[model samples]
Target: MCCTNNCINTENPSGNCVKGYGYGKLIDGENIKYINCLEGKCFDQYILVYAENSFKAPQNSLNYSLYYFEIKCKFEREKSSVWMNIGLRNLNTNKYIYYYANNAKIYNEKDEAFNVSINWKNNDYFGCGLVYPPSNMTNKSPYVFFTQNGKEIGEEILLKDNSESYKPFVWLKSLSVEANFGNNLEAKPFKYDISDHLILK
Candidate 1:
């Protein structure tokens, strides 16, 4: 049977969408670092960083991790509207620690800069070389609203803060192709809508 669902929109809006994944290798020269995907599940679904690029380094002979990214989300022409929950438990302590990105940069321009942001619903610590926001872990995740030529296009969940409940609603607003590259970026300048069905894991 030929079924046309929410996966068939040329303006690439809702239905007629494709479910695929994208990946990229982030290299800084010879000191490779691996950035894995949390929601995506593909062989190339992880970010691999190896080597070092002195040209893009902060200083000569200094170890700087500034790499461009090429991400292939599972659902193309779609935005996130779910608060998918994830966790990492400490075997020694038997404590489950939840994790989420305040914002994420999915792609970069020809200049090779990051265009992503994150909003924290909560912040907690787990002790793994990872830093947490300064607050309690709330059950709110941010979203992304895509647009072009001043026309609304599509949207997706850019970050997953929790799996319980969200308030007001969060969104990843407008991001310049030439934004700064660093951690702790916040989602800004975008609109937010509620989608009680989507979930990220």
Candidate 2:
């Protein structure tokens, strides 16, 4: 069995929870169990793994929580100089599960310094991430959407494209975004985890 929200008798490691993430053990082109516990969220930019018994009881426990993370990106050119803030929230329980930050400073096309912060909150369980640039440069912004079972279920757009990234509202399990640019007007789609940072390329 796989470690997921839909698992039955989730009290212990009854299934392959470790494989649910990305760090699967390698053995003869097969995914072997490498970790013993698995209970958390997966953001495209990062992954938060939790303990099996950490999940709150459905009746008396918060059950849901929210987390937060912050990051900064400074490029040699003004084009890449930007800051990003991310959060993971569970509204039902009003708790935070994880929080992080990544601050980057670049010099001469080289990454000079990077700062990161990670933490867990016990308030709510709401999702958050880079919502995208604002809503001013409609033509320059990319298209963002949510997906489930390999199918798109919801969509959102960033009308502004001036900034390199934006703080998202909630944490999404499976998401995909595409950027349309150039004379060809090509569409480039990217798959991301539940993390707060995503590459526009």
| Per-prediction TM-score | 0.16, 0.20
Q: What are the runs in model 1 whose C-alpha is more than 4 Å off?
A: 1-21, 25-44, 48-77, 81-99, 102-201
Local accuracy of candidate 2 as per-residue lDDT tens digits, 1-201: 233453323243233333344222222221122322234543112122222112111222222221112112121112222112223223334333222222221111111222322322222121222233223423434333332222322233222223232222221111111111111313422222333333332
Question: At residue 41, what lDDT does model 1 achieve?
Answer: 42
User: 14-113 in candidate 1: lDDT tens per residue?
Assistant: 2221343222222332112222223464322222111111112122221211122111112221234222112222233333322223233322111122
Q: What is the C-alpha lDDT of each candidate?
A: 0.23, 0.25
**Total backbone collisions, model 1:** 33
